[model samples]
Target: MSDASFLSFLDDPGFLAAFVEVSRPRAHGAGLDPYDYDRVTAPLASAHDWPAACAAAGQRYAEAAGRAAAEGRGVTAGEAYRTAARWYHVAGWLPHPDREAAARTAADADEAMRRALAHLDPAAERVEGDGFAGWLRRPSGGPAASRPVVLVVPGMDSGKEEFHTVVEALLARGSAVLAIDGPGQGVLTAGSAPEPDYHRVVGRAIDALADRDGLDPDRIAVVGLSLGGYYAATAAAHEPRVRAAALVSGPYRLAWDELPPFVRATLVQRCGGSEAARAFAARLDMTALVPALTVPVLVVEGGEDVIPGVTNATPLAAEAPAAELLLVPHGNHLLGTALPDWLPTAADWLTGHLTAQR
Candidate 1:
């Protein structure tokens, strides 16, 4: 019965279509230069030949890297790095237990950061006086005291770059944003850092940001994506200074009790072999913790999100002291696709709450 339900959900045309549309762009964006989407989507695009397709993609990436390097000046080094990173992202998604694959993905992200640093002015300044990780993005064109500031926390398998798209949008709107690599995320993923202790880590991040110059520390808001949502809620609860919090395609609970069997099975298959994955899963259970959150929150869920159903939203709304839910029709787990349309709404919501408090 579970298998049948799983297969049925996977076969849903709407689900598959949304998944493909969101995933394809991510895959394409992962690489530096444009590649034929047809070739890239050939194998792993579907379950029938996912394994073989992933293997093929890995080979293509490796071969492409060599060719680009040989061509030298014709293909800039930046292109090479992008191509390699794209392959690494694909390699990370492949359903295989290869320690080397994860290591390579981490290494590629590190290299991309290096290249990015060389070209872009250092916009990030480290925050001292805290054990927790924190960084600030200065408001451009002199300090604007009236501008709102946002502190963003990423989900599992996420790093600072995940906010690249959103940060540009916020900055254009005259908002300063601070993004952090919290425990078990980003560079911490490759390090010996401890798994996230929700309230503690977030509290530290807030404490560090509170004293930064040009920031209306009291007007600060928090946006947590995916698993970061759980942490964000907890932080909002403990920190009375946070004016508002938003969760983009985020869930209330850590354990995916509402996930369809196939999705759960897929996760198990993906992480089953890794001790680290197993440990991560075992520690993530936020159901009991939701009731403790007292801040005003906006829960954004995809209408067709198969992993966390409508039921998840209900409990969150009920549990949160003050919360509202926004369902994006035809949206999926990846929030960026709908961000351009939804961010304005989110920004307005944050603006109302943050600015009014002042």
Candidate 2:
């Protein structure tokens, strides 16, 4: 990477360093051991070099996965495939000046995810509707007699491929997972765009899961990250069937002026344009909506988060009929660094709430 480019990577508006650091744990979640993450990233000479290096790292892992599959090491192969998917995803992030390259990397990441899911425990089933797509995974040992289902929603840039760890955690507690790509997210962005009333999408997802066998429709829950947090709460408030909701670093209202230009641009693109995005952001206020959340609600926030900040958790929990706020003193956005502290707890809370109603 050029010296100028390196400085750009360190620039505050971009928050590149923080993005890379936070993404590390996610790569680990994708099965790249810590040592591998360091080894692959240690050689990055500049900001521009990282993506190409990351793409190369993914290729190397993909080759390894192929070899393992040939040797009948299904579990090992699955791990490698997942790791490759993460690396490819990392490359796809902030791919500037080369939109075509970014698209290709993103497609490769999705393919790797599919390959990984094939070897995962209980396997994952690909599900689709008119304008949405997702992958569903049952509990490890297979569906329980009557365990609940949790719909996992991703934030602006995150996709279903990055949610394998969340799925595993929920499955361990006997809850099946449906990690979805809503309108304008992941592979579901062909003709649709992001909407303020995401409950419309959530309601449809619930409808699909309700008709499925082995899942308890009455115990369904929604768990979201960042912007997804907003979507989850809105869904629970508007959809009477959503028994519980969990929000991780979601904002009650969009800090439009506070958002960085690039982030704002992405929002506009996802929301169909500037006017629509602004309209959607304006409609995101949960002041009146949170009071209607009749079911259990879990709001997790990091004290150090700059995007949504710790304050966003207040009104959410205060208005909800049954709600709890977990504040991690040193956590960042999505509480990525605090996963060990929050993931299990969030999963347990979801299980407890769903089970209590039974």
Candidate 3:
């Protein structure tokens, strides 16, 4: 009864628990109004209708942005465009093995975010290199002084457009920000396969950044969320430039047999086959990597974020030599439901380490 098709995948009632009410929290975190979330979900007749509903919502915001732009309302146009991008991102966030609608929507989100940045952060620079694409942005005033950098890595089925708050936070802290989509991620997904050796991707990103003026090549931190937390930990262990690290909801390890149908399907598709996914899952383990983290490391955990068949990052923190855990008892996955409680605190922790680093 289980199939890789997006429709069939969602139609399976057993798969529903993978993301119990995940849409609303993610939507809220992406800046969508609570009423807008209701408007989008309330009309969906079934789980299969989610993509279209979210897509329609994205279109609505996109059209509103067009009107706002034409009417010379810069701020309104920019905000609407950004909201449209987030909606499109949400629409594509599902790990649909089929990849058709999700691919198109991811591209839409990318374009919309690019437009949004024109109005919001005109100084933002697009950075791209092998297996990575992102924006490298400095703080508001300008890049007058060489500043430490913070690289933001998104998790499974997430892209750069989804983490504006992270970027803004680092910028506000007087650090440069590079938010990227790696191999098999975001717009780069269609032609690429999921890579378990994510440190290579981080290395390539650092290679691109190391020579840039106004950036302190020696001081770079990484803030990774969800699966990206795995990448950040791996990079901190291997990439010497990563002086500090923070992982939110990252897995300590992945077991193919234990994963839910939705996760299995997504991995099968992203990894290109069952065999490849199994191999990749094996590499997701951080047992040997955490002990190598000589840099300051922060692990953020949501007490309610537990999902069946998945190993959360809590144990990994305990093992890392210099790791600290920020466990939020009331928070859920991504902590979108409890953003105010964790984000500022996490951001402060990262900035403190980055600035304090000699």
Candidate 4:
């Protein structure tokens, strides 16, 4: 017999597949370490209480963060809080309909992350728009306080919280960075369904950034990861204010019918339901859209990414007038395995292009 809790939902193959998809620390976000992943999922291996196990794992990390903070080890404390946030995010997921408990945990995770970010150099300043929120960071001791900015959008299941590493990477290269949660993403909606008109979402972000003090309004670059690639491309096509655009593992043409059930389910809630979701995804085709791209663009793909298919980069390169395509031979989705390769390349590309504009 099964209980009427979130654990019952974990038994579903789709849920398990979803969990396994992001189980890799290297290939996924920087929030969770390998040890945290194993610790959180270990209880699920048996028939024991899975949620409790997740809580225990999160608590362990929180305690570790406390200890690190007490010792004045800021970096250690930050990393520990990052892991705890991921655990709390997992703990918030449920098999049943009620999401209150999970949302509360996710809020806790966000606070932990904010605290962690405070201890790091090039510290993040929280920013908000009418419908979304984000964190802004700049390079430490850079030539000028005001610098070019890269606007980053996370994947379908992720939000600005998952952008910790990317923000640091951009700052290291002397570029200010802004990572945001669009209408249906993190902090904004408590994990609610997302809208399809991501261009509008991005436009609002740009508008907000335009008034911000320490960023060059005319030198803003946009980068999207995973499903966010689609959002970035669309935003660039319509938002003339964006100086350069980059799509990493984004789909030029969406195949809503072919998407896995887990992906569809996650999207449905964001889009309202299956009917509305399909209609929303169907509008995501960037085929004709890329041709309208008037600014420099970069499309990077992984040879091993079967989900969105690696070949999606081909048409994007051919259509966009100033597009450059980079295909990593053994890279996985998002080039997560090839971070050392792609992250620097993207940063260099943005830096080079934006510098030329200045």
Best by TM-score: 3
TM-score order, best first, reads 3, 2, 4, 1
lDDT of 4 by residue, 1-358 (tens): 2122313444564565456555463425554666657655755653234445665777788899999999999899988887776666555333223445545665666777787777764357887776667878888884666789899997676667666677778888888888887775666545456656677878888787766677888888889887788888888888888889888888776677677555665566555556766787787778768667888999988877776312355578878889998888888777767777788888889878988998
lDDT of 3 by residue, 151-201 (tens): 999887788888888788788988899999998888887888777778789
Tens digit of per-residue lDDT, candidate 2, span 1-358: 2212323433454364555676675566544577877887776655566668888988988899999999999999988988888788767455344545655676777788888878865357777775567877787665358668899998776677676778889988998888888886666643567756788888888777766667888788999887889889889889888999999888888766666554565566566566776677777778868668888899988877765312365567777879999888877777766778888999999988998888
Which residue pairs come into collision in candidate 4?
A: 6-95, 193-269, 193-270, 194-270
Per-residue lDDT tens digits for candidate 1, residues 247-278, read 77665543555554444543444333234444
Better of 1 and 3 by lDDT: 3
Runs in model 1 lying further than 4 Å from the true structure: 1-22, 25-96, 126-135, 142-147, 192-196, 254-287, 308-311
Candidate 4 accuracy as TM-score: 0.86
**lDDT for model 1, on a 0 to 1 scale?**
0.57
RMSD of each: 6.4, 4.0, 2.1, 3.9
Candidate that scores best on lDDT: 3
Candidate 3, residue 100: the lDDT equals: 79
Candidate 2, residue 155: the lDDT equals 72
List where candidate 4 sits over 4 angstroms from the true fold.
1-22, 25-31, 46-56, 70-73, 89-97, 121-123, 308-313
Ranked by lDDT, the better of candidates 1 and 4 is 4
Residue 310 error, candidate 2, Å:
9.4
Give per-residue lDDT, candidate 1, residue 123: 58
